[model samples]
Target: MRLSGERLVEYGEKGGCFVKKMTADDIKDIRELRELLEVGALKILFSKNNKQTIKELELICEDFTSMVEKGYYGGACEADVKFHEKIIEATGNERLLQIYHNSNIPLFHLKLGNALSHMDDYKQTDVEHRRIVDYLKNGKLKESIDTLLEHLDRGEKESIEF
Candidate 1:
């Protein structure tokens, strides 16, 4: 059965049938799987004609940046999830999208929120996200991939510390 967005949020906040507190190993596995999926999604995104998707991504990035600037960490995290989910959708790969949807997105968001709450300077995040958008928009595949990797790496480290 598919989960509604509200249900997913419930799972993330309160735990449910498909949600549980992640162990260190589970976190590691999730990180690895996320990296693999994102890399594949990026490759697919690069090959596709996605002008609309790029525009949407740009808007989301701007929204996220604004949220960060206003000290709205929760809003920023929501925008962050939407940005990544949009990338996954832009891949135009049904299986990849399904995998990401089934993966515990709410839990990932919770971890991300925790990490972001601990950070004082969100400028790095804003810059990196903008760079990813620029790289993708300009067809710089390698640079986009590298920036995405670095962003994910930093996220993983922050999550682990939380």
Candidate 2:
């Protein structure tokens, strides 16, 4: 919420646009946010740590995949949003969830418009999601963090037409 889309465009117009090279603290904050998003995206996309949630997310992913296959990108975008929301909710981190829900979450979902437009590239994201979840399952926090960063960067890139 700190920066608007028009503000971002203004920065681009002035050639000051970039997600900017993330600083250590920036990266730390983003990594924290990404962890929450990845957890949600993966939990909803592939279902991990809990069977019921997994089944539910699998069904949603299947439906969203079908929609994507049929060229209904909006639904895919919505499912992606729901996916992330579920993860944030699962975390029980109210403050983090607020940031995600109010700002980054919408931006991320918006990027899915581009990602779904280029399904092949986005497919890498899907696989990355699963990998992140696998890392979480195995208790590899660092690996999960790395993959989550990659996942977020990919979305950030695509969001700006990368």
Candidate 3:
């Protein structure tokens, strides 16, 4: 027996599913999740010696800088996502990818976009991102991880204040 579309629609209608509004605690949790994911990804990427990864990160950093320069703050936020996503991909861990995917990244991007819109020195962000790439390129794992965490921390603070 095959299920009809109308029956499936009726079944779905009867089975309740709802989207909840994000609470303050939820926002805090997302921020912490982002920190953990980004820091862990950076640690993993730092452990590897991949010149190609560094080059990709450099390209993403340049794209972010260009986006900010053009006042495309939303595009800048997307570039920021791509920057971190590349780091996460470099880790080469499937579970980490799953965790990153499960997080509320779109909402995080929205908050980041809003924060970037209010910032006076967007170039400072580009500099921080470039510093991270520089550290990774130079094979400075400890410095790279430290810089990455600091960058994430600043983002968290800005998102919270926004």
Clashes of each: 0, 1, 0
lDDT of 2 at 89: 63
Q: Compose the digit string of candidate 3's lDDT tens values, residues 1-162.
A: 122321211234667533344455655676678778888888888778778999999999989888888889888888878888898899999999877876656555565565567545367678788999998888887787778777766766665665
Ranking by TM-score: 1, 3, 2
TM-score of 2: 0.58
With a 3 Å backbone cut-off (N, CA, C), the pairs that clash in candidate 2 are 40-87
Compared with the true structure, what per-residue lDDT tens digits does model 2 show for residues 71-129?
77777677666655665665555876787766554564555454447777546655765
Estimate TM-scores for all models: 0.81, 0.58, 0.78
CA deviation > 4 Å runs, candidate 2: 1-60, 111-116
Overlapping backbone residue pairs in candidate 2 total 1
Tens digits of per-residue lDDT for model 1, 15-123:
5556345566666777788789988888888899588988999999899888888888888888878888898999878988888878876457556664667445366
Q: Whose TM-score is greatest here?
A: 1
**Native-referenced Cα lDDT, model 2:** 0.58
Residue 162 of model 1, lDDT score = 62
Clashing pairs in 1: none
